[model samples]
Target: MSYVQQVMEQAIKRSPNEPEFHQALKEVLESLEPVIAKHPEYEKAGILERLVEPERVIMFRVPWVDDKGNVQVNRGFRVQFNSAIGPYKGGLRLHPSVNLGIIKFLGFEQIFKNSLTGLPIGGGKGGSDFDPKGKSDNEIMKFCQSFMTELCKHIGADTDVPAGDIGVGGREIGYMFGQYKRVRNLFEGVLTGKGLTYGGSLVRTEATGYGLVYLMDEAIKDIGKSFKGATVVISGSGNVSIYAAEKAMQLGANVVALSDSNGYIYDKNGIDLKTVKQLKEIERRRIKDYLEFHPKAEYKEGFEGIWTIPCDIALPCATQNELNEESAKALVANKCFAVGEGANMPSTPEAVKVFHANKIIFAPGKAANAGGVATSALEMSQNSMRYSWTFEEVDAKLKDIMVNIYRNASSAAKEYGCEGNLVVGANIAGFLKVANTMLAHGVI
Candidate 1:
């Protein structure tokens, strides 16, 4: 190992409790091995050490009132990992699983993902351990308002801009933006996933999912393959999976499966995208409810089984570490050719190793799902210019961005002597850009 690798390994060993942080840093450092050897300035600057640690981590209590006149409190976190490229920009997730580790992982991945977008944005992520599921609209609004009450103090248009993730979607963004506007007493582009009335960009909702498929399309085309007649299995029925399914259908692929936390539903005849959108987005119901709408579909009680179903492509749109080594093995054993992560770090390091060793065309979340934040940055541009691009225009731009991102990653891997390894490619591509900026800016 090189000096930089030794230093990074030692630093991670010293912080064993921070496995997510270590895993994210290790992946980047491993990919940048060749770059570190070439650019000794990065080693001298201790970029790896600085990059492993977040610039700032904020945690606070979010107290709210329920319709029953009861008080509830949840923990909120924001990990501002790096701002060498620009201001801190990412998303706010509102799920029961929110924690420091989860936020750190997401923020670390955001750093690279944002860098790949070629937009002037840094990396940050924040969220609360408040589950929006089963909550009434009024209850969710109260929770979001309360969560934003404290979050608004630390964020702004130029300082830190947050969008939506997981449980935090249009409704949550609406409530949070309303609270921020009320508290700050100013209407600014402080958040990206805002409603159209409040300056949200057209096609922002479909950006990430569409971007994932776009990246997948690019990767397959590079290998003389196409999405036509490809069988796909997607985890999570949220915005990402819903639109990914839509785009996959448009590309002539059959998306056979989709999942929620409760379980996943598989249909041999291909899933009905409209029914999923209505159940997950409109009704806010569970995945099990799909059985009521389509009796022919098989609903399993866990998400892991989704991978076991035979398919040509797999998209893990659920939470982090959703696909483990076992699931990855199942996919590869079933002749899965591609895996694109729509969710942050949905595959474990072991799962990634399996995919890489088996030569699967794997696209990391940072590279594949960057479309969301890329469009969010575009939204910021529109907010500043007081104009919004049409959906077709924004989508066309998104496709171009994804194509460039894939080329950047592919080229980075080749330059680093790790050709065909996207994990390394993405890390090197993202790290070099941010590291160079940090070197130019000096210690801060």
Candidate 2:
């Protein structure tokens, strides 16, 4: 075993209960073994240890009054993992699954993901164990306000900037931003994913999904293939899945599947993106609602079944570990040539192994999903300049950034003797940038 791996194993042994931190460090160090061998300075500088452990993890209670005139409290967390490259930046997800483990894993991955974007942003993630679903608008607003009340103390445009993820969208961001403005008594760009009227950047909503498709385009191009007439099955109906489907369709790919937490829908005639947009974006309804517009579609009750359908590309834009070894085998069995992750660690290590063994073009989340944070960094840039670009301009920039990220990952993999292995490439590319920055800045 390499020295860095050994050190990480020891660290994991010391904190056995911290699964999120362990998962993050394991994935990162596994691909970085060769890097550590080449650069002993990383070990001497204790970069691995620092990278595994967040600089600060803040957890607090979010107490609020619901619309029903009852007091409720929720747990909140913010894992500020690193700031060597720039300030802490990541999204805030609102779901019952939010915890220290999830936040740490997200933050650790964010460090590398942000670095891969070639942006001047470090890594951080924050959220609360507050499920926004089934809540009245007033209830969600109250919860968001309470959550931001504690979060604003540690975030700013120049410090850590939070964006939207999963259950946290424009509504949640607006509530949180309002709370931050109320507390700080300033209208700064303290949070991203804001409404257009605020200091929000254009194309921020479509960045992650659009970026995923852009990366997929690069991957296919690397293999002398293209998305033209390709069939794609994408899991999750959230922002990432939605925009990914839209962009893939625009690129001449037929997207046949999309899902939510409950289940997925498969339409052989290709999913109607406009219908999906109305159901998900406007009505905030379930994926099953697509049947109302397209009755011929098949609605399956679980997301796991999405893998059974045959397709040329698979994009797991859902939650972490959504794709397991069985799903990976299914994709390979069904002749899937490309898989891009739009969610953080959406594929398990075993699934990744399966894809690697099959020689599939697999792009890791740290690189594929880096577009969200990259656009957040763009939002930060606009905020710094007090200027907002048009939607077309911001989208053009996002595409360029995603293309560059794929090139960087591809080049890093080739240099590290792992050509065509994006997991290794992404880890090395991101780690080198952060490690070099940390070394240059000295131990903090």
Model 2 root-mean-square deviation? 1.0
Q: For all the candidates, what are their Cα RMSDs to the real structure? A: 1.4, 1.0
Give lDDT tens digits, candidate 2, residues 1-444: 667767788888876787767877888888898898898898899888777878998999999998879999999999899999999999998899888888888998999999998889999999989998989999998898889888889998888998898799999999999999999998888888888898888889999999999988988897888889999999999899999998999999999999998999999999999899989889989999899999999998989989989999999999999999999999999999999999999999899999999999999999998888889888988988999999899899899999998999999999999999999999999989999999999989
lDDT by residue for model 1 over 129-198, one digit each (tens)? 9988778899999888888888888899899999999888888899889999999998899999889988
Worst 10 residues of 2 by lDDT: 14-23
In angstroms, the error of model 2 at 208 is 0.4
The segments of candidate 1 whose C-alpha lies over 4 angstroms from its true place after superposition are 9-16
Which ranges in model 2 have alpha carbons more than 4 Å from their true place?
none
Candidate 1 displacement at residue 279 in angstroms = 0.7
> What clash pairs does model 2 have?
none
TM-score of 2: 0.98
Cα lDDT for residue 223, candidate 1: 79
